[model samples]
Target: MQPHEKVKQYLDTICEQIRYKRIHNELREELENHITDQKQAYIAQGMDEETGTFKAVEQMGDPVMVGTQLDRTHKPKPEWSMIVLTLLLLLTGTFIRLYTAPRETNGLELFYRQLLFTVVGIGLMTLCYKVDFTILGEYSSILFFALAAIIVLLMLVINPVDGRFIYASYPLLLFPALFAGVVYSMSNRGYSGVILCGIYFTIPLILSLLIPNITITLFLTLSYLVILTIAIQKKRFKVNQHHALLLVYVPFIISFVVAMTNNNLIYRLKIVFTPSLAPMGVGYMGNITRGIMKGARLIGQGALPENLQGLTVEQVLPLINSDFLLTYITHRFGWIAFLIVVALLELFIIRAFVLCARQKSVLALLVSTAVTLTFAYQTLGFVVTNCGFYLFAPLSLPLISQSSHYLLVNMSLIGILLSVYRTGHMVHDKRFPEKPDRRPFLTIEDGRIIIDLHLD
Candidate 1:
């Protein structure tokens, strides 16, 4: 290929970097229009039309540089602090889980699973980072449909055969599906797209209520809603300074009323009200609450026999390993460790939101919002439930769980981050001349390689 041909290939790749269908259409139109304008200018410069066009194209700068620059203008500066915080939190959580938790028959096995899962998740995250997330828009609907099918398989197909299902380990895939839907819809239809995406997730969530997997259902639905809320908020309040704020509690009010009227809901609500309620129900939360409370007394010494009594030795907490991993932290590492965990979670979420705000493409922003919502809501739910209220079952504990489902979910979030960052960094670091690599060259029948150089 000639020099100009190489340039065209590079531009095409850069355009693919921010590859939303809507944006792609716009970029194509823009490139064609620019090319035409350039050709006209070349003709005016006293040269043969074709020769003028060729020289004009070369003089305008490489197409790749132009396209890459456009993409970069929309990227955000990397936040190193959040990355460090996430790493520290994940590493510390793993250490505490391995060394501090009470031993059981599956002790070594569980530890191995947790460690292996983390490695696998990080690898998956790296893979996600390798591509631009905007490419995910094309498969958003498929992903949503697949998740729905999987939910069905777990509830109907797998549960019956195994007497249980493994949804908890990685129910977080709901975020990517819902997020992709939001990105696609928002680009095509604006805010209404968001509302439709919410409805899409909500329907399955309500359906899941009766499927013995309410936690996963609720988690998915809540994540979708939270993301939509962010979009709505962004629409309501653009950047710069905020004026006055009116905090509304419409959903909270409705939920409170519903719980008050229903006995089962009331029982569930009690979990959030009193940690003690856990012991009376499934033994998961109750054990966690009792263990954390007891563990907090010692704060870092763990639940050794010598200090067990001092750390609420009389209390017998159940499920100290999984749902109640927080308790294990308090028992072994102390309240400080628990606080650090919370801080790290908050930092991870905040960083995600920042990415959403800084993204060049609307789809990336919305997807980032969805990812943030999923992690934030789950984190809040986990914390609120563990604080003494036993309102819900133990969901996957993010980075702490050995469940394959949870592990995948956590990795998916990381994937979103890394992918977005790769694109985002380019936008931030090189706003002037972003370009992709050149295309492969081919020999022509003539002495020189001939190339048809359409800007688009």
Candidate 2:
């Protein structure tokens, strides 16, 4: 066979063993280039064409061995660290609930219920991780419109029972679907992309206003903004400063001003700015929360207080099992335990952001960032509210909160993140081959080939 034919045969052998087809092609191209270079050098040293090709091919080592190594390097693996951290957080939450919950309050029943939710969440997460998240991009429009319709229908049909809307929690579950839409739209370039994003953004915004669930509105708005920012940075969508000012900044300012006049919003703000103004009314819960933290002091009471005897932490602190769970944890477990929880949560957030930054696919990056930002903003809202910093709407801490809806949604998102991590380096669009790595694994030095073999 000719030198080129021999080179092709060698590459074909290796490509057969590579599981990832894209990587297989990439490896073929790279190896062919390296061998050609080596063959040229051998010819320059006065070797015949056939001899040079043979030497070049021989230097590549066994094709099977090379293929196996590449397969191992390129294989998609589960993000075990993320899974372990999630399990740890779940265990911590379970322990906290079991330890601090009052025996008279059906604590055992709550634990069993939470355990059941945890099991379901884990199963859902594993399924999500194993599935190709990119497929969500394919049905983004359908998902977005369906979710919007559900929210609208719920808002119109469901009445407030027990002084709270029955379907209020449903919007929180809309995020992953909305994020998929953002990824789909942003991946489409030009003005069309922006229009698609605007349509998706308006759906939840209008629904939130109609339902008058300002908290969901805020979360959706912030998440959309993050998606938009990433889109702009990646040049998937374009907007000038003037457009941004008018379209984004001005609207945000107007909303803030309008929110100040809202009675429900104003009442929450009042509790934050001047708790003394309505100590027995709107601010009552805030005061009780503050009192619990203060009463706990540094090391905590080690048990329920005499005044609080026979009462669960949930009884004393409103929304203790959901929104105020962190506060209750701080009160019952002291500052040290609170710090540990905070550290774990922070680590989770940071790792997620890191995953987002490392993603090569625009869809994966946007999805990862959206999920991370959701967790981050929710955590900030809850922590700030717990610390008496603001009168923000209550949001459950991800993974740690006892709210079943939040638990399922948060775990599903974590699974999506893991999916993104596994496929982050993949190039989805054939038109855009991934940029060649400037820092190659194989390089020639002092007339000798050096294989770094270090996967970054």
Candidate 3:
């Protein structure tokens, strides 16, 4: 046998003992390099080629033992804590929904629906955990455009709840994650790439604008801002930091300004800050929510004011199962429920952020960070609205909101997050490799136009 065959056979035997195939290549490389180094060291001491190789393999303990040790070391591990937390949150949401809902046919119906979403959500989370998410980064552009196309298409269909096409903003919830992929794809493309990101952002921005859905508009705006900031801070772009930031925020700033001036959004903000100004108008829910909070006791069933016109407290603000679930729990049960819910949600987001930020792969880090921020913002929006700030019209707490549509969206986001944490160690990405000076799309030498057919 050739001298190198000994090393090859050693590695093969070692790999055979390791069951997790995902790290097989890395394990093989590590062992091969180590054996080669030992063989060369022996050769430097005047040993012949075959003797060096044989001696190296013999001195290294049994391949089975080595591989067994490594098999235990290198394996794909899921974040069971996050998984358990997710299931707990889902159960909390289901219980709260049934608790808030009337005890009748309608309540049982809601129970069944929540049960279905919960089961489906768990299944989706499991599937996402099993599948690798790195491939999403591979087809980043396709996913972005496909998402953009869906946003545009959804704009044409009217949302039944709000009677507005843009109000059907479910797709907008995922904009942040796919944008992470776009940001990764545009890596090393320079200022032009950064500008393309802004351009791509406009599709959803405009849809949100026409839909005039402030919640999603702000969701998209903040998501891109945070993500691009991360990219620029990391020097992922090939342009000046200041310049790339300018390119990124120009559209957001413009949208913010346009939204403030155009949509009576300014009036809405005014009422949210000072609910009494429109106590029976846009601020009705906020005003009632504050009333409920003021009357809430520390541990017992709090009383709703006698003046309010409602058969039950749910009739006062009407979103008992979703946007106002926290408020309902606080007022109806006690402050303890509120604290528990807040603690769980806060823990989930905080820990998720800590985990996501630790990702070694750039794409994984970016995507997971974006997902975390989306969760954070939506939670803030929902909590603030429940805590007597602007009702925000349609903000829903992640797992706490029991709506069918949002249940799916929230589950999908969790699934993606679980996917990231599950594969954080298993999947690696080359998102920022130095590119070869391959053929350019266009050349302008000698005032002549040369379109290069070779695309890298």
Candidate 4:
């Protein structure tokens, strides 16, 4: 039989048993190329054509086994480590609420609500994992504009409840998705890619400023810097240091200048930098928080500290269930619990970075890395603010905080990250053609085919 006919027969047998038909053509092309190369080597060594083809086929091992092995390698699998860590964090948040629930406030009720949110978040995450993340890349422009419009509407229409502005959590939550799309769309474009990214970034920046939520604005700005840096590092965009610095610092300078004019912001800055100068009425919370943290020491006050048990939420610490939850944890459960929470957060962020490194597609890499930075920055901000380093933002810890919007947004981002991880290595024939096998298992040396069976 001809070499081509024999190869086709073998491929047909292998593909027949393979479960995933989508990869059948790719696997066939790879095997054919390897077999063809092997046959050519045997012919060069003076073997007859028919014998060369037969020998090449013989060396490929069993078709069924090869096909099954390829299927297993390409199968989609969840990152269970991430899922478990997320659940653990969610449980910890529940424990904190139960332990610190004031007599007037229903602790059990809050825990049930948090549990419901966790269940919903996990379901959404699973859906994201199963779907093709690259599809988001295709519709990035539409998604960005839609999200941008939502932010604008929220800014104009939503009235502040209790004199506090509502955060743009929906827009911020969807930022990574919109970002992944933008990055994918501009992947091969040169300088234009950077320009397009900058334009996409402006929408959130403007909306956050309009809401006068400096915290969200700062978060968005930092996210933009991270995305830009990753793009430059990946060689997707070429940017000089001067231009990169301008891209980063220019907006920040402008924002800082604009923020200085607001009296409320000026007061927050005083609380952060010069607490002694802060007004006695409003800035007293910083002092109270410091006292609470100091009283906790190495071990916390043991679930319900006698000193803090009877105090109401307003009297104990403002925003205890949301922004001040970590502080409350330290005050009630002690530094050890705080450290445990921080440790878990570090693991989550590190895992994200590891996943980002493993991504083969540039768009996935950008999206995953952006998600990692978003979490990292928020965690840092939360910790810093709790430690009394900065008093300007009410940034919540990713999964440990009790805000419904914050929890849902962060969980959705985690879902997108998992999606990117699952689809990172997928390759399509149109975009990435199969290359000649160069795995170093076999080589043509001195006009002869040499197979190195020894594992390195």
Question: Which has the greatest TM-score?
Answer: 3
- Candidate 3 TM-score versus the reference: 0.82
Count of backbone collisions in candidate 4: 2
How does model 4 score by TM-score?
0.75
How much is the lDDT of residue 70 in candidate 2?
84
The list of candidate 4 runs beyond 4 A from truth reads 1-66, 102-108, 149-168, 238-267, 279-282, 302-314, 425-456
lDDT of each: 0.57, 0.70, 0.78, 0.71
* Overall local distance difference test of candidate 1: 0.57
Which should have the higher lDDT, number 1 or number 4? 4
TM-score of each: 0.71, 0.75, 0.82, 0.75
Task: Report the number of backbone clashes for model 3.
Answer: 0
Give the per-residue lDDT of model 2 (tens digit) for 286-349: 6666666665646664344466678866667765666677777787668777788889999988
Best candidate per lDDT, number? Answer: 3
lDDT of 1 by residue, 9-77 (tens): 544665776533335555655565675577678788777866865766666676566666766664544
Of 1 and 2, the candidate ahead on lDDT is: 2
Candidate 1 minimal-lDDT segment of 10 residues: 239-248
- Candidate 2 TM-score, C-alpha based: 0.75
- Give the clash count for each candidate: 20, 0, 0, 2
lDDT, residue 446, candidate 3? 94
Question: Considering summed lDDT, which 10 consecutive residues are worst modelled in model 4?
Answer: 429-438
